[model samples]
Target: MWRIVAAVVGLYRMVMDATRELFIRILMGILIFLGYVLLSLFIYAIMRRIMVPQKLHTLPVHLQYTPGCSDIQCPFPQAELILNGGKKLLSSGQYYKILLELEIPETNANQEVGVFMVNLTFHSTDGRYLSSSARPVMIRFKSFLLQILYTLFFAVPLLLGLWEQKQVIELVLFESYYEPYGDGALSALVTVQHHGVQLYSTQLSIEANFSGFTYYLYQWPISMSVIVIISIFVSLCTCTVLMWVSDVVRDYDEQRRAALQRRRMIQARTTGQAAQNGLGTQRRGRGRQQVGSNTALPPALEETTGSEISSEETSTVTGVEDLASEMGRGQSTPPPSITPTEGSVTSSDYSAGFNDVLSSLHTLSRELDGQEVGVANRNIRYRTGH
Candidate 1:
């Protein structure tokens, strides 16, 4: 079981080491793609700026005023007026005031008086025109409050769109925390038209109207696009940084694991060595015990044999003394019939038998002592050999 676990761990480590470079390459590729996307978006923004049409809030115009009477020889006939580099035109839903200043000459009292009418016309680049009466005059001042209201009508929505674009940019690009809010795409469209003036004559009972031109105004907020591009760029950078940090962390963890494994291996080796040492010590202890038992056995056997031999010698000696006493008593009673020669022969035989018993006891004691010495010597030799 432990072998299987170790094999699995080794395989995992090998796989990680083999794929480490591949993982890094993949991260780098993602970062590159993100950078490419960011560049493409930047180019697109530039192109859009160059290609997209912008709204023109004003137009230039040239105005010429001619007197109606030729015979009256009116002064300042064919007068040219330039307003705002010519005459500026306002878009529909927009209000502006135009102030015109003209110098007139005082007529002499004797000269004949004549009524003159002048025609004032306004023309646009699109071929639309507006004409005034023979003499131009202001009918009345337009409502200042109404003009302000008209200005606000166009201005408010434009301001709101700008504000919305700003908010969207901030939320999408700058905000770290994510939230699902607002529209994904931003767009704005505005349309405006310019209509020419109307002239009415009470006595002639005639009315004239000029054609006017219409322009369409469009505003697209590219800020959201820019935000998306910026977000991609930022995300790529963040991913790169995170990948680096993760790699560092992984390396640190691997090092730590390696250190731990090394420690475990050292511990295992130490423990195994200790076990072997313990076994060796136990064997030595058992060997010593066996030697001691063997050495002690010989002494005990020798002691038992010596005690038996001593007891047998004591019994023999006692028997010998009894025989000698009996023989002495018999000598007093049988001396009358027995000769001295026979008595001498019997004494010699008894002496010979006692000497033989003494010799036998001496031989037994010498053999016992020699055997005990030999056994002790053998035991000592065996212990030294061990």
Candidate 2:
């Protein structure tokens, strides 16, 4: 049995889930229906109250026969009713002020009644109450003073059916807790008795009416409340959907931003790499140019060997010194004879001459081979055949 129950419950859940949208649509439809119903009720109530207003119902048999009703006379044993004001009907579910008057016949033909009873039974089948049938709300009392006495002594209304000597029933405020409509009953019964003998009794079908607050304010309370609750529910759902959409948008934006940032970084890195490559190419080209320059002679160098240039430079400097010295001495005596000899040639000159010769040889060797440049730069030393 438990397994069966579980299976049924699971099936029910599956069905509900499958038809969830249908159920929601049905609920929304019900809410709309209720709203429209309320609107119609509101319009009708306003129009009805204004157009053919309900004539306040009062008692006193005062109408050459009230328009929609027949008057009930005293000591009436048979119930009779005549109603004519059918053009207007009182609204349902409201309060009304009722006034009743009773006459004492001074004496009841050989029987004086010590007490009398009046009962007004009310019933209605209008409201959407749990009971589909007409529900009754009957109020009974002897008189206005006796009704108070009953209310005080019984603490609830003379439910014990106690009768006290009294005359007129005062104006009473009646609240129709149940909704009123056609085919409902408003009965009035009066009984006079003394010493266990009934002297007079009257029963009448009285149509009651009154003036007070309108029913549109509180009509179909349950339906209106349901509509309000549904409205709130729909608002909540809308808010939830909006929040979810916002979250989705926020996530998408974050992802797009991150992707854009990554793309920018990648582009920056690629640009930096390209710049570095270009610089390296420039440097390599410069290096090759430098190497090609070294492999050949330059225009700045003369075709005359570096050795010949050095010798010319030395001889010119020696001649300038000799000329300067002879100018300072006597014109007849030539400058002191200067000859190139082992002792006359200064060690500094010999060293310089050696360095110049080595430099010239280095340049010639490089014209042969571009390797071992410093090693090739050495003073020339000629040795005898060994």
Q: Which one is best on lDDT?
A: 2
Each candidate's lDDT (Cα)?
Answer: 0.38, 0.41
**For candidate 1, lDDT tens digit of each residue in 1-386?**
99999999999999998799889999998988877786767765665443332333222222222435334343333322222234322322322222222222212210122222333333333334332223332223335586466557768676776422111000011111111122111111111111111211111111111122211112334654565566756776688799999999999999999999999999999987876665455435324333222121211111122223344454543453444355445541222232345324354443444344334334433433434332222211111010
User: Candidate 1: lDDT of 208?
Assistant: 14
Task: Name the candidate that leads on TM-score.
Answer: 2
Q: Which residue pairs does candidate 1 place in steric collision?
A: 83-86, 117-134, 118-134, 118-135
Q: List where candidate 1 sits over 4 angstroms from the true fold.
A: 1-235, 292-386
Model 2 Cα shift for residue 76 (angstroms): 41
What RMSD value applies to candidate 1?
Answer: 28.6
